[model samples]
Target chain A: DAGVTQSPTHLIKTRGQHVTLRCSPISGHKSVSWYQQVLGQGPQFIFQYYEKEERGRGNFPDRFSARQFPNYSSELNVNALLLGDSALYLCASSSATKLFFGSGTQLSVL
Target chain B: QKEVEQDPGPLSVPEGAIVSLNCTYSNSAFQYFMWYRQYSRKGPELLMYTYSSGNKEDGRFTAQVDKSSKYISLFIRDSQPSDSATYLCAMMSAGGTSYGKLTFGQGTILTVHP
Candidate 1:
C-alpha cells in the first residue's frame, strides 16, 4: 500500500503571507499529525487529529492550525508567516502503535 | 532546557564499526521511546520503537530504553555507508492531554564511510 502522501513538495512564500500544506494519510489510517522541522533540527510537533477531532496540540503559535477530514486527510495552515516559519512540514499517519511519515513539504519564507 | 536532549554528533565511523547513539529525556511520564532516521531534505522514517524499559533488536539495529535513568540508546552493528543519516530520538507520553504527541531531540548526524 502507498504510504502517507503530501502535496506541493516545495513552496516559497513571503513574510505576512499565508500558506496551506496538505497531507493524505495511508488507507485505513484514521490518525494524522503535523510537524515542523528546521534545518539541522528534529521535527517539532504542531497538531494531531484523530477522527477529525483535535487530539493534541504543541507549543506552536495561533498562526498555525490544522484539521482532519472525514476521509482522514489533513491540512496545515500558517498565517502571517515569518522568516522563522521556513522549514519542512511533515505529515504522519498512524495506526494504534506505528506511525509513518511523508516526504514533507519544504516551505521557504522570505 | 529541551525535554529531550541528544548529542547531535556529526559522527564519522568506518564501515563494519559498531555505532551507538543516545538521548536523555527529562519527562518522567514519557512511556514510548522511538528512534527515527532522516536523510537530507526528507522526512524522518521510524527505525525502532520501544515501550518502558528493555532492549529490542531488529537485524543490525538495537534499541535500548532505561526508564529509571530517563535515557535511551540505539546501536547499529556492522554499519554501512548507507547507514549515514541523521538519527533522531523521540518520546511520547502514555496518556493524558499529551496523548499521541511525540517529543523529539536534536538529531545526531552519522556518516558511515566505506
Candidate 2:
C-alpha cells in the first residue's frame, strides 16, 4: 500500500504571508501528526490528531495550527509566516505504536 | 536543556567498521525508545525500537535502552556505505496524550566510506 503522502512538495512564501500544507495518511490509518525540521536539526513535533480529535500539541506558536479530516487526511496552516519558518514540514501516520512519515514539504520564506 | 540530547556527529568511518550511536534523555517517563534513519531530503524511517529497558537486535542493528540512566543506544555492525545517513533517536511515554507523541534528538550524520 502507498505510504503517507504530502502535497506541494515545495513552497515559497514571504514574511507575513500565510501558507497551507496538506497530508494524506495511509489507508486504514486514523492518526496523523505534523513536525517541523530545521536545517541540520531533528524534527520538532507540532500537532497530533487521532480519530479526528486534537490529541496533543507541542511548543509551537499560535501561528501554527492543524486539523484532521474524517478520511484521516490532515492540513497544517501557518499564519504571518516568518523567515524562521523556512523548513521541512513532515506528516506522519500511525496505527498504534510505530509511525510512518512522508517525504515532507519544503517551505522557504523570503 | 532539550528533553533529548544526542551527539550530532558528522562521523566518518570506513565500510565494515562498527558504529555506535547514543542519546541521553531527561524525561524519566519516556518508556519507549526508537532509532530512525533519514536520507537527505527525505523523512525519517524507523530503524529500531525497544521498550522499557532492554536490548533488541534486528539484522545488523541493535538497540538498547536504560531507564534508570535515561540513556539509549543504537549499534550498527559490519556497516556498509549504504548505511550512511542521519540517525535520529526518539522517545515516547507509555500512554495518555503523549502516547503517540515522540520527542526527538538532534540527528547524528554518518558517512560510511567504501
Best by lDDT: 2
Give the distance in Å from residue A41's predicted Cα in candidate 1 to where it truly belongs. Answer: 1.0
- Residue ranges of candidate 1 with Cα displaced over 4 Å: none
State the lDDT of candidate 2 residue by residue for A1-110, as single tens digits.
Answer: 99999999999999999999999999999999999999999999999999999999999999999999989999999999999999999999998888889999999999
Residues B6-85, candidate 1: write the lDDT tens digits: 99988999999999999999999898999999999988999999989999999999999999999999999999999999
Residue B9 in model 2: lDDT: 88
- Candidate 2, residues B1-114: lDDT per residue as tens digits? 999999998999999999999999999988888999999999899999888999999999999998988889999999999999999999999886886689999999999999
Report every candidate's CA lDDT.
0.93, 0.94
What are the runs in model 2 whose C-alpha is more than 4 Å off?
none
Return the clash pairs for model 1, or none.
none
Best by DockQ: 2
